[model samples]
Target: MASGSASLMWFRKGLRIHDNPALQYAAEGTKFLYPVFVIDPHYMEPEKNAFSLGSARAGLNRINFLLESLADLDSSLKKLGSRLLVLKGEPSEVLIRCLKEWEVEKLCFEYDTEPYYQALDFKVKNYASTAGIEVFSPVSHTLFNPTDIIQKNGGRPPLSYQSFVKLAGQPSSPLSHTLSSLPLVGDVGSCVISEVPTIKELGYVDIGQDESSPFRGGESEALKRLNEIINDKEWVATFEKPKGNPSAFLKPATTVLSPYLKFGCLSCRFFYQCLQDVYKNVKRHTSPPVSLLGQLLWRDFFYTVAFGTPNFDQMRGNRICKQIPWNDDDELLTAWRDARTGYPWIDAIMVQLRKWGWMHHLARHSVACFLTRGDLFVHWEKGRDVFERLLIDSDWAINNGNWLWLSCSSFFYQYNRIYSPISFGKKYDPNGDYIRHFLPILKDMPREYIYEPWTAPLSIQTKAKCIIGRDYPKPVVLHDSASKECRRKMAEAYALNKDLNGMVSEEDIRNLRRKLKEDPEQEAKNKRIR
Candidate 1:
């Protein structure tokens, strides 16, 4: 422990003050510490192959949410007689500059394992090592470190959720650390701490609040929500993940704590301990793979797999994923993206996702299915890319993993069991209240025709004041036929087990594409088997 030394605390995803291992360690044995956040250009600039550079890497909804989170974190730091130093540049360059100018003896940050972050952290670590600056990095982003858990499982991450839960077992007690006092550094020369950037500054328009989603980002709000949910012992004890209604727009049955978790506004370990304490008192406590506890387990499972698996974001070369020739239909994909797919059930969920920057788990399942195998048959990567931009809670590991699961490209493989773009939502929201609220064009639509307005006669549509192909675009494709063709294609691909690295050859994909245009079961059978 070096006394009277200066330390730099680089804030990344773990933005909150509580249960933060890196912050706790950095503040220790030091008289003063400076908290810093670097705004990386990588996130603010488009990649070389990006479709467009105007939006950069993130959408308006996520940008607004992130800016709010940063502001909240700065406020929390202020109450403790400190402030956040915001810097805009590449992280390695900024960190190197700070290390020399601030005359800092140590650098501390939470461990992150995403490929991009991993590479950046490596550069920073190497620089610190060469310069003889101590770096204190503790893994706190997840309940358990993915490396440790995977190593315990024979150097490979568990393939199934059940396997992962069995290996992870239970949440241990939360770390007993507190930031009762934080000492300020002597001087931060020439590092004029910038304020968190606004959406306009980041080149994005601010997306206004969604009446359906009442979430506000910050450590305070996260803790408040955590307390409320835990205190409701009845909800905690009786909580079953599957039974929660995705279409319950009035109020989501689930706690809706994911965005907080994603931004590290709340500590996963602390939340787990609190949940366990409440769960102990209840007579009927649900278990993992489908409980509130199960959600955390699912998160960890994805993280572990992502950490161990290379190219985990895509289907090619992913050992765990089953390769299939997925379609690249931009027109249909665009329709899905803009909420004009004419399937009220699918369109409503997309509206909710874009408006709120979050949606229920089953709703995610519904939309992801529609994009991949259910209707559009677009590649899962396309959906993952869209989600990465739109979701405030978008995580590299979780987002890709879930898309693969829903698409039957990996993790899950019940390709025959595709989600119905219509009845799945109707099962939960039979009266179509969810559709009416999100897609106001269908607000006056009769309950029967709400999910499938195209099926209704012109008179009924006119009476509702909404017309198919005029007000809302007609269905992108007939759900029944398209999904069936998709399933057949998936089956043929799976049977072939061919590894397609790029676009499936135009000629080969043309045959599958033709299946969408006409019934070609006999054609598909003869071509595939031969």
Candidate 2:
């Protein structure tokens, strides 16, 4: 708080200059402010533990987007008379070293909810406290602090989206911090600020550009895209989440600002204010649970739940997740991961995900359902892992929450209402244009058989210049039978565990699995046995 002192503005999720509380805090009452980004090995390296199955926390696609964001942030800082100091190694050690070497007076950063990040932040804060350094940490990730919401709701989070909405009440007006100019950097004798590392330097091979994606990462791009949406008053006023067609390509039907949001390139509160401005100008707008603002609230809802709940990322020990015996078929999971499931609709969506590192929300729903309950009946954790590795916009809270919702593990339980991999895409895209765009192998197939390429007659397949089971793979699992079996298994599990509730432990799952495996009656009904 002393004037003419040095402060370090450590960047995490909040990669932007506008509406950044930590950055604003660090700049005020300081003669020198150092903007720093640490490329922590914790995330840059692949997690090789048993549960991870040797997947990197961030794949090339995400790393590429991150590097772009950092470069843009650095450019923005330089314009303001400072540059981002890029460092590598563990965050706590890096920050501690900077504190001593730079002779810093304050340490500031945006707060996050993931357990690993929370722990890392704690260590840094502890060190700062011991060293008698002023520390200022603020929440700018979500519209409202998850802790505040949980405290207001009797120390627990709302289970359902509607309940969450009612409990959340309404988002407050966004806070403003005006600045004519940022602090000028004084001579830091020997502190060499490294430039943002390239994708290869971050220990990943560059996958190159995705032509399917019309997205670019950074605060400038975020604002530009946001302005385009807000300027279209009619679109903003009439925006509907469910009605947006997922099959549309080249131009996303919805605002593709998710990557910006994930990296904190755009502030959620600022976005909310823009939405409000649009609503006031039009004087007519849709309500929550489906509206554009509703989408953001959903993000906060998941954060609140994830913050309060234990074992939120996994099924076994999660209190709310249903105890379904998900299959452990690596081969089936591999096919799903590589976009080779052989169902054209699902495969196309997967291909889009791999290439673009993003998919429309409805497209996400279709694939998640197919992977968990609709087709393969594989564990949702496997799907969650794949998303973590691939999605440029993947956040721990949102990713796990959506997987649980779609898998019928928690938040939802319409087990029998399966998304027909074939029909779902056809409804949005009657001509199978989405399928054809991604899966060119079946691009020439007739519209009727595009979603079900395996069903095309031999002559029809030959004429299309592609052959199923040769050029493209056959359907890994028949939709109808697999869905029915999944439903039956779910019904049985629900019936057996009707009275059970709250944080079913690993031991509990092990016992249940043992019983299910040993029982002859259960074996007779095993979906995989068929």
On lDDT, the leading prediction is 2
Stretches of candidate 1 exceeding 4 Å from the true structure: 1-4, 42-55, 170-172, 200-207, 210-213, 498-530
lDDT of 2 by residue, 1-530 (tens): 24448999999889999988899889988888988898876666555552322234776567667878999999898888788888887788888888888788888999899898899998999998998889998888998878878888899988888878777766755557655567876555565567997766655544546443346778988999999999998988888999998888777878988899999999999999999888888878887778898889999999999989999998866788888778799988988888888888899988888778898999999999999988888999999988888788999999999999999888888888898998888898989988888988888999988988888999999999989888998877777767877787777677655756444556666666565456455334433321
Candidate 1 Cα deviation (angstroms), residue 416:
1.3
Prediction 2 TM-score vs. true: 0.93
lDDT of every model, 2 decimals: 0.82, 0.82
Q: Model 2, stretches more than 4 Å misplaced?
A: 1-4, 45-55, 186-192, 203-206, 210-213, 502-530
TM-score of 1: 0.92
Instruction: Summarize candidate 1's per-residue lDDT along 486-520 as a digit string, tens digits.
Output: 78788777664564543355455556556544655
lDDT of 1: 0.82
Model 1, residue 361: C-alpha shift (Å): 0.5
Residue 359 Cα positional deviation in candidate 1, in Å, after optimal superposition: 0.7
Model 1 steric clash pairs: none
